[model samples]
Target: MTQAQSFSSTIFRRKPVVGARAPGQAADEPHLKRSIGTFQLTFFGVGATVGTGIFIVIPEAISMSGPAVILSFLIAGIAAGLAAICYAEMASAVPVSGSSYSYAYATMGEVVAVGIGACLMLEYGVSAAATSIGWGQYLNELINNLFGWSIPNELTAAPWGVDDPGWINLPSVILVVMCGLLLIRGASESALVNTIMVSIKIGVLLLFAAVCFTAFTSSHFSPFMPEGMAGVTSAAAVIFFTFIGLDAVSTAGDEVRNPQKAMPRAIVGALIVVVSIYLLTAVASIGAQAWTEFSPDDEASLSRLANSVTGSTWVGDIIALGAVISIFSVTLVVIYGQTRILFAMGRDGLLPKTFAQVSPKTMVPVNNTVIVCGVIALLGGFVPIDALWDLVSVGTLAAFITVSIGVVILRRTMPDLPRPFKVPGYPVTPVLSVAACVWILSGLAPVTFLFFGLWVAAALLFYFLWGRRHSKLNTGPASSADEVSQ
Candidate 1:
């Protein structure tokens, strides 16, 4: 066997493949089922990409860059689109499920894979928490608008979030727990559900745009570049969080009917759709009110803009309802991603074997899903939205940079390997993609950087203490299970 093939199989501890296993194994496929298609995958991308940020993060983006946040979205979209192309190459070349962790393992090395996993936790885990926190706010908006009463702060904030000073956020925790239950029960967000949620998310924002446009005044753009280039780019960094879900497009690699044709189109297509929606919304919101009014604590902020423009509570109520539903779905999709990554790690022997185990009856990674749910629940229950945002941005940007860099490394090592779509401008495209992501990453708050440093350090420590010693590679390709118990 070729060295890369031998190396990949051995390190992942999988049975030697005499032939390529089909996309999704049918029978003995252990939590593996060919139940998706290009449409559904695209729907997954759209659904996961829509919520949280567009609803709430918009206010912050406005507060930072004013109407120039429109410029920020344009810049961030180019960067996200560029990095996604790199990710597509890695996903296709590596042929694995755990996103960057899998790509790093197959192409980079064991140590890189473990470290990337740390970043994935930030990308998916912290993102799930951040998204859930948004869900709580929207839910309260819906409840208050519909019933004229909202849940008490103590019940909604985590036991840990600044209770007057509690450390945790309660509503977010409850949402996470509910998602965990659904996942454990083998429920998944099907294509229809994803599409419906995406529609709701986009619809709400579009609704805001339609209503707020009535108040449109060209004067809103008077001080267009008021923040200067530095502030615009910095706002781009904060606004960049909304773009993190674009990577969801890459993860659907295996299921597309014709990945080569379908992938490039879907990713670029999705990027265009998202960037347009964001730009339009920013313009509308800015027209309705000055950027300074976008307080971080403003509950149901966008919906409030709707009410402001229409002079009726109905518009805001509808926006709040849409935000609540869409954010909940986004949380579920992100959490599902986290469990699958852990499952891949377990299968590779990097994590405990129990993680990869699937309940035969349910055909889901019950234990792994449960563990992830519990951890995320704790974070959501206590951590505020502001704290989770930077960690998510930093983690995702780091991983994107790795993917962009990986494209260069893979091209050098496996020139002959078939690639459906070559990143348009190989060396330049990848290099630019990396630079753009770094610029945004540079603007992260100091505390976020410190936390990210600690997270990466912890991953490295675990790799040396356990991951490296127990890696499937050390024992050899699918070596008898006997040698696996480090």
Candidate 2:
């Protein structure tokens, strides 16, 4: 065989260098602006993290552990915080756009990157769908409060919803499409919009907490651990979905100003704020109503709690309006994260070129955004919210474990590489992160694990059949102009 043929056969091998850019692309893409700061990045984390689960996951979590769900929040928060720290180290060290997918590729190998990319797609894409479903619920609540009527149940609910079965979820599809349109415009505008949404979301949650406390009764604390330690850990696994977007901060590593100082602070700050608010809300909610009264089928449980506590529909209307706005922002951010991950994979030759194409007019990957919106909208329109949540949690937990392990591997392989933020406890920190993730993974339902296994296997099969043969590294080194940017 000739030399060229021999070189082609080595496609299965890993791409060793970090931050490898595509051939002919400039060091800085002309379209994507690097204008995000610490404040903007923190909001990205907060905006993405809070709305996805809190708006919808509360009743589901309450059903799982009763009043002990507060402890579950703390457990999930710590696990997420540790994983985010490890994520910061990888972000600062690699300085890439793919989030965990890029970090896995640069440090682990091509195969691992492909696997993690699959998990991230599920994490962000399904998260977008789930949040949109939640948004639809809040929109219904808002309309009912303001106009004394809502869209017909047949048009607003998925088929699996017990109370109402619909042919399609119209509102969720519309919301996802709206977010996609905004994303196609550009990233800078999205960041500004997200900051505003974050403020509104935080303000409303605080208002709800304050009002709910007026109805607080100490008797609500009697049976805190209804299901015991087992229930607390299980609820933590379920609530883990809320923290999935904390890593969105790290995904902006290449876009942030002064990443070394900014990244860790933004991540930690977001975690603290998110966890504190969640705990306060959980306490106030159970205090306002009996834990047994939290109906798992109610998507707008928080608003309902507010209505019950204040004996009027006015407060519930305010909470619902805030949820509708903030959940829209959360959907936008997660969809943005999904598009970027696919774009990075395309650049490296793991997927189709259309994903990597950045439109000259907008400086964003318009094609990728559109594709993500199409898929996510379909899921949100047809799939039940409960069906989507566990899948998101499973994918996110697996991806977090991969990131924690990657940190340990990079430390051993490239000890001298400069990391803007290091995991504080060294090997122990990453190890504990991995352990926590595994424990959470164990708590997931067997059906969830089975579905996750099938999804991952399909992803690996695709890589072996197509990705290995078409990789950019198989061709040759990237052009000097497009060499990996530091």
Candidate 3:
């Protein structure tokens, strides 16, 4: 039979719900193969979650909640882990690869799937921009420490930063654009590389922890609840943003040897590690100085602590250098996540197929990735980090809440579906997850909530007007939407 005839034949033949495979003619996913193992997955989670928020976000969190910011980390981790568990089941059941976009497509209607895709674009795209700006601060610090050379703060700060006044962050935009090029050129990160990067990040944090411990004193904890209940709640919301990447642990549903066992184990394991590290770092920082003293302008705040401890600039330099490496990986991971969400939408025919079409030349979605990179670069260059963080938090919380609810929806709709690892305590666990996310979301600034509302409205509007009519799933897919047991 000719290729077209074969394609037609394959289209009508559907696989069972379990072990469903991608259509042979749907186009190869990419040139880069799945090389990540469980350990790698764990590291990707740690690497992506460890540095950006902990080192830099603390300044804002400290200012918001005083020393009680540690509680926020715990709260955020619990909610994120719950979401990840829900995601793992859905991902395993669907047997298709993508994040919320893919899961929403198979289980929810095409319209919601597209809306989720839009949400994802915000989550990843702005996140990439956010991570880059955070990266830029450390870059400037590193330069200053190494050679006493630094870019003028004007070039680095967005014109509208809460504290720093600037029109745009030129360096941040440049960094995102560079990462886009790397990804477009088919540059992929390996699990081993991510694991090593995670190690470097953890080591640096440990160094910060150790150095601070040397100067630890109980006096810093005197005003532990200075910001009171409201401050703790508000700080939790901001701090919750840093813990968003903890779900990276569950994205590898297929490659994991024993997904049901591996998925939950890894999720819990990664969460524990992340929380412990955060607690250690927070305690160390708080021990070393007053909780109210953290500077919003200090991007390399943890490294600065090390500097103050040793009275030598070398420790800060080391921290900055490690941040540069680790955050580079973060940019890669965040950008990668953003593109994948769009790609899933494109493949589902909700957005332009071009967005999902993998380029034969690069064996990746070159056009789509490039477009995403361009948009993020613009934001990075123009948007301030503080402005970016709230938006990210809203997107994440909304997505997490949806996933938590999705767990209940899927359980009720497909009760018999094999879930590699069913979330323990089912209805209760999912409910708790949703509540936690909403509580955190409640802490968002009014402007951020308004911005989030506008974005979501745009997505739902697009879905109602356009995405619903173009869903690929309407015709039937080559594989099962939800299939595996976990």
Candidate 4:
């Protein structure tokens, strides 16, 4: 091969399911411990996803689609559900840490892997930051209701968030740090804590739903689809990040026990729970309060709605408390997913090796966790939450599209590959998954498209300059076209 052809081949080289890691690496070479089960895995998805968007997305969705925001929820849920099915198949077949990045690497090539990795990083990292920002708001609300005091706006606000700008978001910074500490201890501990948080939050949301329903009026939902299909889809795009955690389950492929069975179950289970709760809450909130009354400025909108419906501060306090607990779990899980993605990249030599180093004592990527926390803290503290949400949805939806495409590619390229969980409809399912995600993508703002394009460009540039030269597949012995499993 000519020099140019050799370079092209190196860039496009695919990792095999087997021997994709450093050649001769032992089966027990200390990857993340496989301790997470189907149950905890489901909570990881619910925990990471629910708190981030549900607490805030209702008003945002309502602001766009009016009472028809309920339909927007369904649309986003369907798209997310479809993509999650594809993710299950990929996670089962690849059974790796990087989520779609790992899937793309094994099925597509090194370049696509880098691109997908960038998208996943954006999804998890930015969502963590954004969710943490909201955590600060709920913390203040809880404190205010319980003790007649709250964090000062100056300390609680992000400098960049024009909606309620402040010098720094102290509560958000603290939340990010606290979650990072929990993650450093180990995944099992983190998962246990997250599951508890998920339970509490779900119960709180249900309570809110029941309370709001007491004041339900059929008149509120009369002009459903007020924004038409365009409005519903646009709202769906805005709130799509609420469903982002479903893929967090796939990112745990390396740490999951009985991954082939656990992954698909966890993803589907989490999806059902998340979607049901969101729809219920949306219906109740809209039924009790006119959709026109939802203000984007209300931080604890659900809690306020409860307080208004019941005419008591105590109920709102409880909801705020739940938000505090649940958003913390969201931060914890998202940071965990982000670190694992970096760990996968590090293992591939696409990043500095320190990121891949699992601490001997904890059996987790301590260095990777710390780096993720620091970056997330900075973003959460300084960036406006408003700026982060759509960006997260854009990255997540893009990654979802990649996973759907990867399913089709893998099925054709490796038809007999062991897939413990096949997407039920085969070609139709994956194709629909891609189309659904694309439809959601169409609703994103032009500025979001520009920013995402720039982010992808930067990621590709880094790959050529640094990751390309250091990638393990470029230096390791050739891989066998065989399967590896957790």
Comparison by TM-score, 2 against 4, better one: 4
lDDT of 3 by residue, 407-486 (tens): 78778767887776778788888898888888887888899978877887898787657765665645654443343122
TM-score preference between candidates 1 and 3, better one: 1
Worst 10 residues of 4 by lDDT: 477-486
Model 3 gets an lDDT of 0.70
lDDT of 4 by residue, 1-486 (tens): 899988877877777765223222447654888899999999999998897677876788898899888888888999999999998888777777788888888767788889989998988889999999998888888898888998888899888766667899999899888998999999999999999999999999888888998999999997887778888888999889878798888888778887878988999999999889888988899999998898777788888888999999988999999999989888888899999989888888888899889998889999988899999999999988888888899989988998999888888777887888999988999899889999999999899989888998999999999998888776675442243322
TM-score, prediction 4? 0.96
Candidate 4 clash pair list: none
Off by over 4 Å in 1: 1-31, 159-168, 185-191, 252-265, 477-486
lDDT of 2 by residue, 185-274 (tens): 888888899999999999999999999999998788779888788888888988897787787776666566776678777888888889
Report how far off residue 12 is in candidate 2 (Å): 6.7
Q: Order the numbered candidates by lDDT, best leading.
A: 4, 2, 1, 3
Candidate 1, position 63, lDDT: 73
Count of backbone collisions within predicted model 4: 0
TM-score of each: 0.89, 0.93, 0.88, 0.96
Model 2 has an lDDT value of: 0.81
Please give, for residues 309-361, the per-residue lDDT of candidate 1 as tens digits: 88889999999888887887788778877887787677666788888788776
Global lDDT scores for all candidate models: 0.72, 0.81, 0.70, 0.85
Residue 230, candidate 1: Cα error in Å is 2.7
Between candidates 3 and 4, the TM-score winner: 4
Candidate 2 residue-wise lDDT at 141: 88
List runs of model 3 lying over 4 Å from the truth.
1-32, 162-168, 185-192, 249-265, 477-486
- Per lDDT, the best of the predicted structures is 4
